[model samples]
Target: MKNALGSVDSVLLLGGRSEIGLAVVERLVRDGARRVVLAARGDAAAIGVRLKDLGAEVLVLDFDAERPETHERVVAAAAEFAGDLDVVVAAFGVLGDQAAYEADPVSAARSMAVNLGGHVSAGLFAARRLREQGHGTLVVLSSVAGVRVRRVNFVYGAAKAGLDGFAQGLGDALHGSGARVMVVRPGFVIGRMTAGMRPAPMATTPEAVADAVAGGLRAGAETVWVPGRLRAVFTVMRALPRAVWRRVPR
Candidate 1:
């Protein structure tokens, strides 16, 4: 449950090893979250230790975003381990090579399955639990790329666009159910995920995004844009003519 100060008590991070997800969990723990469940495919031992050091009861579970069949069971197990998840972060995604996706359409479909389809399953499952318990926040890590798909990474952008819409609709559906969703749209984040990539204008870091998410959670914001100014940037970008937009470099 969330305390009077709007601080959560427990958190479930679907992308346990994600730099942004771990950063958010770390911030929440520092802000008084006592229990955390990290669900991901690979080992979470290091993050578990880090969270433990921050005074959280940490539990690491195996979760595969591509495996929709196991999502319900994973959510159930998380609930069983940590009663009433106050925050559930859906941060798993893949930014595959655009050239590869262009060559292999099947690969693009697989990536979409993880980014958009997996969230559809996990988001609904988490929403049901939050509704049953009557209070919680589901944090959906969307991207500015979704706001206006760029030609360079349209495959990834398309998936994010779909996810952004789904998250917004889900939030609306959960209104007045004592639960809500926070959609975080961040500009290019210079983190483990975007390693070796050229920095985009107004690029941010995982820590910055996490900070924004934590502040948004406290303020009960339905949507948050990291760096804050990206909201206005995207508004203009979204309005640009296709002729001008298509020429914008990656």
Candidate 2:
């Protein structure tokens, strides 16, 4: 639940080690979030130290995005740790190599399961808890690639498209429940996820994404675009003819 002054009292971050996710959690803690639950497959000690330095009570739980069966259990653990989840950040994904995915269809399928299937289960479970509490926020980190999936990375983009649509429909389902969902669509983020990848047009950073997310939460926005201009760029890009669009570039 939020404090009287509107500061988030507790938060649950699904991807504890994600650069963008960690940045958002740090921003939230700086704003006023006191209790935090970080779920990740690996050790989150480094992340824990940072949040603890920011004066937050942190708890870490083992979480594997590839396993949907454990999502409900993780959410319940978070709720048990911190009375009511005031905010939940669903940020976990893999920026897989398109060529590799093409060569190994099985790998691509697994990636899809983690990127899309995992979110579906986690988001729904969180929504259930939020609805029961009648107050909370779920921040879904989507990508502009979903708006217009390019051949260079269609596998990853396709998964994001599914996630974006799911987040929107889920938000609509929770209307008037006081448990709103905020969807963030950022362009190529130049961070750990894309360390050596070529920088795309209007590429943003994890920190920038975090800042936009914080602002969106404060404004109660359903959708937010990092740099605030990609919305217009994608609008035009989406209107291009198939032939011209395909020939534009990777």
Candidate 3:
């Protein structure tokens, strides 16, 4: 539950090892979140220890984004351990090889299953609990790439498009139930997931994204754009002519 000051008492991070996810959890922990549940595929011992150092009672639960059947169980387990979840961050995704996806379409589909499908399942499971408890927030990490698909990473962008829409619709459905959703759209993030890649023009960091999300949640914003200026940048980018848009490099 959130205190009168809006500081949460517990948090559930679905993607325990995600750079941005960890940053958000850390921010929440510092903002007075005491009980933390990290659900990831493998042992997130390092993350658990890091959260513990921050004065959070950290618990790691096994989570596989590709396995939708197990998502409900994972959510239930987290609730059992932490009582009513105050915040659930659905921050699991993959940046697959675009060229490889073109060569192997099946691989693209499989990856999208986890990238998009996993969130669908997990988001719903978390939403249900929040609805039953009648209060909570679900933070969905979307991307600017989804605002409009690019020729370069269309495969990944298309899945994000679906996810972005799903999250918005979920937010509307849960509007009056005392539960809410926050969608974060960040430009090329220069983080562990994007290591060695050339930074984009408006590239931000995990910490920047985390800060934007925290502020957004406090303001009751439905959507957040990291670095803030990217919102205006994307507004122009989304309005460009298709011919010119196609030539804009990522």
Q: What is the lDDT of residue 128 in candidate 1?
A: 96
Estimate candidate 3's alpha-carbon lDDT, on a 0 to 1 scale.
0.92
lDDT of each: 0.92, 0.91, 0.92
TM-scores for every predicted model: 0.97, 0.97, 0.97
lDDT of predicted model 1: 0.92
- lDDT per residue for candidate 1 within 113-203, as digits (tens), equals 9999999999999999998988999999999989999989999999999999999999999999889999999999998788899999999
Worst 10 residues of 2 by lDDT: 1-10
Which sections of candidate 2 miss by over 4 Å? 1-6
Candidate 3 off by > 4 Å: none
**Cα-based RMSD of candidate 2:** 1.2
User: Which regions of candidate 1 deviate over 4 angstroms?
Assistant: none
**What is the Å distance of residue 190 in model 2 from its true position?**
1.2
In candidate 2, what are the lDDT values of residues 11-75, reduced to their tens digit? 89998888999999999999988999999988767778989999999999888899989999999
